[model samples]
Target chain A: MIRFDNISKRYPEGRDALQGVSFHLPAGAMAFLTGHSGAGKSTLLKLIALLERATRGQLFLDGENLTRTGKRKVPLVRRKIGMIFQNYRLLFDRTVFDNVALPLVIAGHRHQDIARRVRAALDKVGLLDKERALPITLSGGEQQRVGIARAVVNKPPLLLADEPTGNLDPELSRDIMRLFEEFNRVGVTVLIASHDLDLIARMGHPQLRLHQGRLLNPEVLAPPQ
Target chain B: MRPPAALRVYFLRHVQVALNSLGRLYRAPLASLMTAAVIGIALALPSGLYILTDNLQRLGSQWDGGANLSLFLRHDVSIEQAEALREKLAQWPEIERLRLITPQEALAEFRQLSGFGDTLDILDENPLPAVLALKPAAEATRPEAAAALKQRLQALPQVELAQLDLQWVKRFNALVDIVQRAIWILSALLALAVLLITGNTIRLEIQNRREEIEITKLIGATGAFIRRPFLYSGLWYGFGGALLAALLLALAFVQLNAPVRELAGLYESSFRLHLLEPGQWLLLLLCGALLGLVGAWIAVSRHLATIEPG
Candidate 1:
């Protein structure tokens, strides 16, 4: 679902975020992106999400070239991927239901369809009862589950999470990772960027390791556990 | 039995956004009212001035046909001779209507109006001369034409003086013209003020909702989708401001209408304050809504691009 041909990104201030990065994750595969802080994990995920463009080389998602996509077309392209953030990034003023309903709303889904899908997604994340609760009132793990529901509500074929478990306890982190595994098992391509090497080892997903803006090596691919 | 699903959805989205914006305003009543009131005052000043000038223009046009001339007959000119002159002048194409006011009738009118009846009764001979009042034709009502008519009438063999008070009438019309132009200039400035006020308000709103905007964008919301609520908020501000301005104008009208009617009554005129017609009210509302929409559009386009998922 995602392919990068030697993608390189450089900041305007002459800082290199990613250099000579090339990878291809076939459709329906789940992978973990592991690196220390500032190891270009977020940058690579950003490239896939079209949040930022590669300074050099072409990037493709679902067989479409993202490098040549115009700014106006970015939203439509982004709709095909569900993105989760470490902070959950829920609108605190809104209820958990509203937060999860956002993607479907953006897609202009019917009201009944949105309600049905939102409940199902929330149910999948075990946040069914907290749908009407505000994100501020939810615990850290619960808030992350709300974020997960939101990301998968529209059922995008590809999901990208950036340090999604960064602020969670180890148990909560595993629960979040398990939710991702569940989505991946249903044929949704998933790529998660994290600095937690120990948690990643337990998931047993293939690893894409980076160091100082460059991929380290073609590491051994781990079968899904 | 209803609209297409897509059309309904589109319309419902707009209604949803509009109501959401209104709800936000409702939640913060004080700040919203303040901003809207400021806009209202700005809009009311120009609109009020415009209505005043419009009324003045109406009053001025009513006097357009009063461009008449009064010809004073010579002291020795007999009633028969004055009557002959009046008949002859009445035949002239320049004169629309002519009336011969006899000396006795003139004296009686002057005594009654001037409150000098006792003093006038002491005089052996009537001091007032016979006058022939002349109503100029429409074509002769122009300043130069009226002046020429006056000069011709004054040069008559049996006439001593001819007066046409067209100058002051012309001056009043010119003054009204100047005031109308001033109102136009004021309206333009106030419209700019409205735009700036709404733009600034939306700018502040965008800043406060920066995180929401960024999060929405990050989750595949288009620029237009994110802009919808802000635009609706602007619309509400402008629409509310217009309503307040209309109320203010109505209050002004009510306060001034009675005194104005009394003043007109003192002059034996039946003129009353004119209220805005339905079309004019619609225009005011439309102007407010359009300005609000544009201001919001500008603020959203400028600030939204600067905000990304970063």
Candidate 2:
């Protein structure tokens, strides 16, 4: 449900972050965006999220032209998508329950709906027992789960994860990937940006590779074993 | 599906967040009280000055009616001529009230009341001149108008000189003018101080919560949404400060009332300190809210933009 056609981005200081990149993903599709650091993977995700405008070329999310979208409408587009970060980005001052309930709160859900949905999302992340615990009291993996729960609480159509398991151990990272897979199986499109080629190989998903701001053909990468 | 309800709910949620912050302040009652007291004193300085100015103006207007000219007739002028002049002066619109005092009558009253009857018996001719005590109209009570009227009265052949009793009133008016100007300048300076205090407080709060804001932005929170709670916090500060100021001013007026009344009683007069009217209270509350909102807006707009999902 996202299309980036010949999109290019260049910083004001003469750095080309993305160069004539194009991609399309159908509804309910899942893919991994693989690249090394400074390989323009974040730039591609930001363009799709409308956090940054492309310097040239057109981009669309669910057939809505994002390249020409006004700044005021960017929030509308963002609300329909969820984002998970490697840092978890949980508010340490709040309980895990409030942290996961945030997206629904931002979407103006009723109090009953917020309570129900937050509980369900926390349940999905296996953090239902730690609902009242503050982020500072939770372990890193637990905090990341809270972030994942928050991302999916609003039931957004698309989920974008920027190195969601970057700080976790191999076992925890695999478990997190399984959580993402479960959501994808339930019809939520998921795009994850990562440098973990081994994890990609284990998952056997379609891979979109970026090198020096250019998209490499997915077919050239050996199929995940 | 309706947007207005959604927007209102959004705003209310932020308001809830703001209330929670205020709850934190309330939890530390003694510190909050001390801080509020300082803000109250800061706010009360200007409000007290404004009340003083208002009362001073009221007292001045009461005595504005006291301005008058005493027109003394020449010793050589006959009683009939003095009577004719008095009648002529009565026709002038500027003269609100007048009374004639013939020389013979003036001397008789002076001798009886002044305890100088033995000294007055040695005089062959009456020393006192016939006088017309003249009160001016309200519009003609200013120093310039009184001086002009004095000059006009002196030009009359029967009149020796017209003494305008405007010295005390002129001095009081000058003092009131200065006090009014000082009130304006002080209010402006104090308002600036209020803005700075609120702005700095909000800035510190933003710094403390920088992580929260960055996290919010990363999770798709809009700038407006992120800025909402801080704005409410500022508003709470302003509202509290203004309420404290109003209370302080009211207490001051209450404390000063008895002494002011006793002093007025010494002059056989009735005077009271004017309490803040309903409209003034509304203005104070509104001022507080606006100060809070503006200060928060400045702090949030400057710092929140620098934070991103890096």
Q: For candidate 2 chain B, which ten residues in a row score worst on lDDT?
A: B57-66
Over B1-310, each residue of candidate 1 has an lDDT whose tens digit, in order, gives 6569888998998898899999999999999999999989988998899898889766754554468789989999999999999889979998889899999999989988999889888899998899998788867776788898898988989999998988776777678778888888988888888888999999999999999998888888998899999999999999899999999999999999999999999988878889799999999888888888888888888887888987
RMSD per model, one decimal: 5.4, 4.9
Look at candidate 2 and give me any clashing residue pairs: none
lDDT of each residue in A88-199, candidate 2, tens digit only: 8888878999999888776678888899999999999999999999999888899999999999999989999999999999889999999999999999999999988898
Q: CA lDDT, every prediction?
A: 0.89, 0.84
Mind giving the per-residue lDDT tens digits that candidate 2 earns over B1-310? Answer: 6589778776678778788768866876785566556666778898888888888767765663457689888999989988888898899998888999999899989998999999999999998999998888767777788788888998998889888877876887788879889888988888787777777878887898888876676666777888888888788788888889988888888899999999988987776778778998899888877887797788888887877655
Report candidate 1's interface RMSD in Å: 0.8
Please give the distance, in angstroms, between residue B139's alpha carbon in candidate 1 and its true position after superposition.
12
How large is the interface RMSD of candidate 2? 2.0
